[model samples]
Target: MRFNRGRRSFLLGTAATFVADFVLLVPGLLSGRSVRAAGQPVSADSTVITVDSTVIDVSQGAASGALALVTGTTFNTSGTPEQGVRVRALDPATRNEFARVFSDANGQYSLNLDPGIYEIRANKSGWGAISIAVTAGAGATHIVDFGNGAPPPPPQEGTGLVTGTTFNASGTPEQGVRVRALDPATRNEFARVFSDANGQYSLDLDPGIYEIRANKSGWGATSLGVTVVAGATHTVDFGSGTAPPPPPPQETALLTGTTFNASGALEEAVRVRALDPATRDEFARVFSDANGQYSLDLDPGTYTIRANKPGWGAISMAVTVVAGEIRILDISP
Candidate 1:
């Protein structure tokens, strides 16, 4: 349509203003700036805008093809959860790192990785690093756990270690001593180790009360009681010097006795008995032969002697026996 100068100029000015607004908004949109609609600025709430040209896979939750998802957890050598451990997915063929993440508080981590052979490594401070080879499939989920290159930990949790030193009664470090950790409740030796040349020893053990026994040849054995806590190293010391006192001299006293009837003649087929003066406990018993004589070895102690026969009355007397000495006693019934 033909228009007058005034109307055409006005329309031209309005079109130019609209074009300028479009140009300014274009840069803002690319820079993540919010847009206003209907003359009011949009709130901070975001709206997801999808383009028709972009295709999404309903089943895979990605485009027609995407990288695989890898999830796993990191643990210490003792199998305790290791949070904040750094995990990396490496392509061994190219030695390139494709993805990296830090483990969560639960020691869990996830990564979107391209389908290929990868070397997954996990590392943390004070822990041995671990790496594992895996073949990831596209659109597939895989798991790879790490335990600092150590064997799987025992099922029991929160276990700890015990360490100690062995010393002689003279306060000198004792080497080659055998240290044993015994479970008090079960009375079983759960763990054992030897003291090194420096008299240092260690044992990984469970939490509980234990008796640590240290022993060696020519040295007396010593034991100490300890209570172990989870994830802790309990230290103990043993001064096990000084040889045990010599065993009391073996009993070697000889007691010879004769049983006789009221006539004071040798009584054949008679019974002779020796009893301890204290506790009234029977100490020894012997029977006289056809000659009515019996002999017995006993510790050096005082004892009561008695003579007995089925038809004869019982006779009793007090006798003292001495070590390495032979004593003769006569019993009459």
Candidate 2:
């Protein structure tokens, strides 16, 4: 459903720590001869060496608009990464698809979108389609992953039809009503059709969660959640004259930081991670740029942040964020 609201831009936050240490040893003499140094080498006393530490601090603040990100890998039923799967996100208000992409050779896809809730779907030839719902608040990042963990769904069944009729508040057959059958697990549409003059609609679907809805103009009916069996015609009816209200607007927060190396220089191309404190699932990951600057916009909450680089050590810290606040942190490794 559409709501009257002003559009805003998305914001980003960065993460990093700032701490370093150094240890130096002096050479000693023995038996009036310069003690031969072992294989160990030492820098001149005048030379300064800085060793990066793994401590990070995160602060929070408000954001006007926020940049939202969705990224994850796609795998097959065999538990192997798969490529070329079509990933899609649908805008709730327009019911029109806003973003679509294919998994790369590594079976990964990423998309940047405005703050809102979306219906995500993925499918590939020889694989069963999947769907799920995700809420991407202003300046927030979320990840939705898909895989059977077993074997891919076998070939789809060729039989089964879902039939439905729609009636108006007056108990008369309603024509031109839009009907949709969805898979609740992936929040994906199995089929969509409109009612005929007789207010009858039909869709052939494989057995799964039998969720369906009907909408006409600005009014709609409550969703019917049920289960369907193969080769059966499931009959459900919609007779509501009410429209669901719009969801409340979401608040946003900001997080940002920089990454540095042992020499106290900005380090670029480091992968920074944000995880849900309770589930420990990574929700977002961004890389440092040429200047070692990074940023994120997110819904305020407690999260575990981490930074990773190949040769340097990894760092992890926990922090809480509140709406409309800015937090700055530094990381060294």
Clashes of each: 0, 29
Off by over 4 Å in 1: 1-65, 148-333
**Over 4 Å off, model 2:** 1-65, 92-95, 150-333
lDDT on C-alpha atoms for all candidate structures: 0.53, 0.53
lDDT of 2: 0.53
Per-residue lDDT of model 2, residues 1-333, tens digit only: 111112322121232321111112222211110111232211111222223322222111222246466667777767678777776777544657765656667777665556765656667777545544455666655555555332212222443555555677566667667777665334466666555444555554665554465666743433444345565555556653221111111354556667899999878667676788788786555555444655554567888988888997798899888876667778887
TM-score of 1: 0.28
Q: All candidates' TM-scores?
A: 0.28, 0.29
